[model samples]
Target: MDPICTLAVVGAGTAGCVLAARLSEDPNTKVLLIEAGDRMSYFTKIPLTPTVAQQGPYDWSVRTTPQKYSSFGLWNQSQIIPRGKGLGGSGQINFMMHGVGLPKDYERWESLGFKGWSFKDLRPYFVKAFGTASAECDPEMCSADGRCPYSSIRFENKKAASIYILKNHRELDNIFVNKEIVLAAGSVKTPQILMLSGVGPEKLLKKLKIKVIARNEQVGKNLHDHMNTPVYVSIERPISITLSKIFKFNTLWDYVWNRKGLLSFPPMAGVEYFGNSALMLFAMGSASERLMRDLSNYKHEVFRKTFPFHHSSSKEGFIFLATCTQPRSRGTVSLSDISTNTPPLVNPNYLQNGRDVKCIVKALKRIIKIVSSKPFRDIGAKIHWPRPERCQSFWNGSRTSKKIPKPAKTLNKDLVKRTTVAENDKKDRVKMNTGNNFVSDDYLECVVREVAVTGHHAGGTCAGGTVVDHKLRLKSVTGVRIMDASVMPSPTSLYPNSVLVSMAEKAAEIIKHDPAIHHDTLQKTTDRRGGGRKCVKHVRQNGLQADQVYIAQAQVSENKTKDANRCGINSAFYRKKFAEVNTIKTTQQCH
Candidate 1:
């Protein structure tokens, strides 16, 4: 008899590992945790450098199919989609920026029929999983004494500059939250795990030759990611501290000896503003002014208290931020084949919707305008990678492609004519067409194409209700459950890590209350003969009859083909090839 484990968790990624650790707390439950890779404690918990955590026993280095829309028509040149294969999963490789979704975002989940998943309902779990942030916590936003540590690092040059830019843009003020196994394993591996364990499209499983344990068509569909346009600014002073330069002897020794210096901060740090309903209601217009005052008061308090390093830096550095809240576009993840060892295909269909393009352009223009404002003008910031001319060229190229004639010159003239006509119209036709009122169509499309990158927020594969029920149990299969980012009903606008943790925590509670161990079924096993013991006699007879059929066909075909081959000199080679082909055909027929 095969050994019976109380529970078999297939992945040791963020969600899987968290489930393992939490479920094992019961002690009576013997959890069989199987990781496709290695342990999390294998590497020391060091920040900034992810290279140490990305290879050998830890990573599943999956590459995406060339993106259908990205990088100004250049295909497959976007950054490689790397996901962790081992314990702790992407939490070990991620740039440790702890964040949570807006409260309204979770309320939206409740509206979608996910019971016990609203922000208010899930708040305690988020608090239970994270340690208190050093920054001031809004009683409504942050939690204390959670499983995962949440604190701001001592700001180095890059982090400090980024914070300074974000402070002026008071629109971004959401807190980070997490609980249980904060599923930080990222986009690529989340769906890969779901499909590997038989929780995806039924037709895909048959094509790959995997057993159909569950038939959830939405398992690997509706993938979404946030794309960022890096605000590359050339600082007058040489920037000594960066993730790449942190390994130098001085920096390494300081970290090794005192656990301080540039190595303490995460690889990158920046704030984000949402363009969704949450941001518009609280952080825009006259209401935004009141929030800004509250934020300014909070910053003053933060500076006075424990964090003295929150002050702005004089040296110039780059700023990177998200362009929009909840991109309208979506993509998918699917199995490459039946092989469990092979990585599944990851395809984040970026810029599929025209609104996503407009949102990105509006966000970019807002950042540029903010940086050029009085608060940052004294700092002497300048656009580095995409100079104004490059931005213009990209806009021209996008417009040229959209015109009736595919050529560049014709498109430019057409766009100019269209712009003049739209400006003259009283009803504002241009605003309706471009989605965003501020930016031109050509400019918006260019930003979307050029700045496209993964936000690493992928979900809805093992989606609740539509795929699996709210309990996460497979609708058609017994003794199998899904507990990863794929289980999200929809992608939240916030960082997915905290929400995933809440899911694992809630799933653990659900499992404890019902105990999946006492289910009323046992898995059937196949014997050495490749059939159940009850079918052994019938299977043997079928095999014998199949063998007889193959022999009879071979005897008749071989004699007839050999006799016909005697007509020509090249017939020997033709006969040999024909025989080889016939043999394969006969073997297939035998089954």
Candidate 2:
């Protein structure tokens, strides 16, 4: 006999996992988790799996429609967008660097008039949920099962699935949504599923012969990603994570038994210089570090990719990942075919904007300077030239399958004389993001359009300002919610896996607390408080918090000093503190 579940959650990735784990805590409420891929296993436990996880059985080898302006490095064709196919989803194949979105990003949602969706409002949820994949339970803090056990092996008996055969797969489970349904599939597939399930723009759904469930004009629109310019540099001392360390017999043995070693190190371990939150002051001509402390949004960053140590000839390397924060380009995921067998058409429209190219080029130049600095030189790290040559498949002629070979000469200077834009105005063009002889605005643009890669932080499809409400419910559909990265209104300032997990944690709480949801059976989330959430309260943002709007409002005041005093309190303190420190240094120098 098949027992009906109180909730049905789609996709068993990060968000899906959290939804299933948290929702099933109540003995009276049954949860069904539907996943397309098999259970998590087979090298998924390893931390440094990004380099090897692709092209394997677990990766959905999805490609974008060839770009006219971006992805120039991929043989002038569509970029290969990798999506994980297993239960863990991208968390299995990702670089494993966890960073949250900036406070301003969440404030943008509040600015758009969506309440209960700010960084302040969400921070408590983040702190309360998702800690150490293993259990971290305090008997006084939680009930016996309040700690969510992350191991798939441990939860084998908990959920049900459809479209895949398992011990609990039901033949008649063609439709879900008895009590409520949540789409935790990522930005890519969530839109695809909604469209295929007949809940998208009416005109498109009609063409695909899908029965219209909801008319949503914004289902798959406003899609964007963190476009990055990656510069690979060789380690001077040659001590970095290598492929041999990841796959060697001892490493395998260590993980199989003890689950500890270099194999356990996250991708953030590769960062040798600055962090992921790099401002473009150096690239944008800020004369002093103190001068640019208040400025942000140019998230050009540096980090390292694991090296293939088996090839001893190759030096251990680090990757400087330059990012264009708040990219202007937007795209859509539409139906190329209605069949589930055919993957959805994902067009990120990478680097379509001229500004995105300039920002990335400037950021790349900053990385070059970082490598040339005394600190990098002291460490023996050098920018590996023509790095695209190392990967033949991703080389210059990738579309044509003819790899671009390395050039023998090296131009190691700090700056090049190329212009920022190919604008009609020659003066503006000359003032572009400068690079060394090896990289010019022209050269970097070509590199950018061709070689720039994604931060894999794709979002904004089911945006809070458009498609979904602040509660993450579909605008046109009832009894449905989205609790994945796909529902993010915009791409965060950081790598977004942590944010996605935080979102799941929050969404679970929101669902459990809503009076209208499961009114008869499910009690308030406070009915039981074994976890850390009992200590935190969801605070609401009552006033305006949009940065641009605040700035604009302050600018309207006739008295400049009064406006500055009112709005720029933090900046004023920083500048004053900087001056005092500089004064002390000057006095010491004179002595």
Candidate 3:
């Protein structure tokens, strides 16, 4: 006989794991979590191994169709969009940076008619999702040194989140849902899965010859991602992380024996946000020519001379990653073929909006200023110009010559001294001159068009108010709820994982409160324990309707008492409503 569960959650990603763990807290509720991929690879446990893990079976890295306005320097003018495969999903193969997003981000969702999703309502879930891990450290202390002391800057679960959830729950891997299904398959794959399951835009489903269970015009539309471009700087000293340091025997020994060392941390050390732009610092350790080419798909000849095996004598470098937090450009995810084996076509229409280009350019200038700042300069860091041949004309020198003059110190100094205005400020403005300035705005814009790639924070596909209702219920269909990044009404200013986890926590509570799932379960449990008749009689005697009395029949068990409390009724209130239901003597009698 097949095992049956009250709820089934698809895609064991960040939200899926959280939903499974939180929903399964009820002893009466059975939750079956499903993941298309296998368990996460062991290497995923190490913080610095996402790059290596991404190359393995744990990743679902895909290439975008030649971007219309960006990725000109990459091979075929396309960008690589990496998604994680396996239990943890993308969270397993991502840079472990924690970000909660700004309060206004959610307020905007509320403004869009997504009621009960404002920052104030979601704040409790955010604290619950982060848990005690946040309580152990002081944000001010971590910020002082430009490095957080925590071994990993991610949510509490460092391993595949399902592993943590299942280890404590002892649940089944596969089962049928008797009540409802929750889809947490992430933004990219969730839409794909929905389309494949005959629920998506009617036109696309018809073209693919799929049986249409539901026609939603908004399933795969409104796809947006954070776009990032790296500004590389060579470090003159060997103090930064390097391949030599990573391969040292002591490094491995310390990680294996004591679980602390260079390998204990992520390669991308820290991140800071300013206005709508964010700067992520990567310890670009001893970048080889091949590695550089792989990281940023610059022209081969340009990459060869521009960033050699080791740019400086120390063979160490760092990357200032400038990210446009709020991108206006939208893209789409569509099924290329009917078969689930075929990956969906992704068109990240990056930098198509003039605003996105301008945002990234400003961030790039900010990176240049940071590299020239006292802190970076103290480490002997020097900027490396990645002037591909196509963009050579934008620079200061002759377009034909390989020799280029140093960037203008005046421009860097000016940018450093300038106080940035808020995004909403009408006075926010900057004047530009593309003429013979050492590194002009034209050059920065050209670089952005050539090199920017997805920050891997894709979302807003199965958006709220469009595809799903405020409660995350799929509008076009019944018995289905979408609880993941896909339900985000807009792109967040930071990593979406933190927001996704919090959403799941809140979603679980919302699902629990559903009268259908809870009422039926509670009614059956009361009957099985022979307390339903007594409860109904007590309610009738007290001039209360039988349906209004939602009682939990239990005895001397802490878990049962907690479960009863979760029903939204207190012991005193229940006693006042029904004094002698099922012959219970006191409030403690139920426990």
TM-score (all chains, Cα) for each model: 0.62, 0.67, 0.75
Q: Largest TM-score belongs to which candidate? A: 3
Between candidates 1 and 3, the one scoring higher on TM-score is 3
| Model 2 lDDT per residue over 467-498, tens place | 77878877765667787877877777756777
Alpha carbon deviation, residue 68, candidate 1 (Å): 1.8
lDDT of 3 at 339: 47
If both were scored by lDDT, which would come out higher, candidate 1 or candidate 2?
2
- Kindly give the stretch of ten consecutive residues in candidate 1 with the minimal lDDT sum: 159-168
Report, for all candidates in order, the number of backbone clashes.
5, 9, 1
Residues 132-201, candidate 3, lDDT per residue (tens digit)? 2111111221111110000000011111111101111121112234567787877887788778767788
Q: 404 in model 2: Cα distance from truth in Å? A: 26
* Residue 150 miss distance in model 3 (angstroms): 36
- Residue-level lDDT of model 1, residues 1-591, one tens digit each, is 322234544454556544654554443444434433433432325664543555444555555676667644232433344465544555555555456677877776667666667788778877655532222112221111101111111112211100000111121111111111112234555455546545568888788666555577877787766665443443344442433344468888987798687765554555647464111100100112122212212223321221121233332355444355677777788877644345567777777787777676666555544555664556564533332332454332233333221222213565556664434332222322221222344654565565445555566655666655777665564444567776676667746765666667677677756633433222434335553211112211101011111100111122322212110001112111111111101111111
What candidate 2 gets wrong by more than 4 Å, as runs, is 1-3, 130-133, 136-172, 244-260, 270-313, 387-438, 522-591
* Cα lDDT, all candidates: 0.45, 0.52, 0.62
Candidate 1 — which residues are off by over 4 angstroms? Answer: 40-44, 51-57, 72-79, 132-199, 208-211, 237-240, 243-248, 277-316, 385-441, 515-591
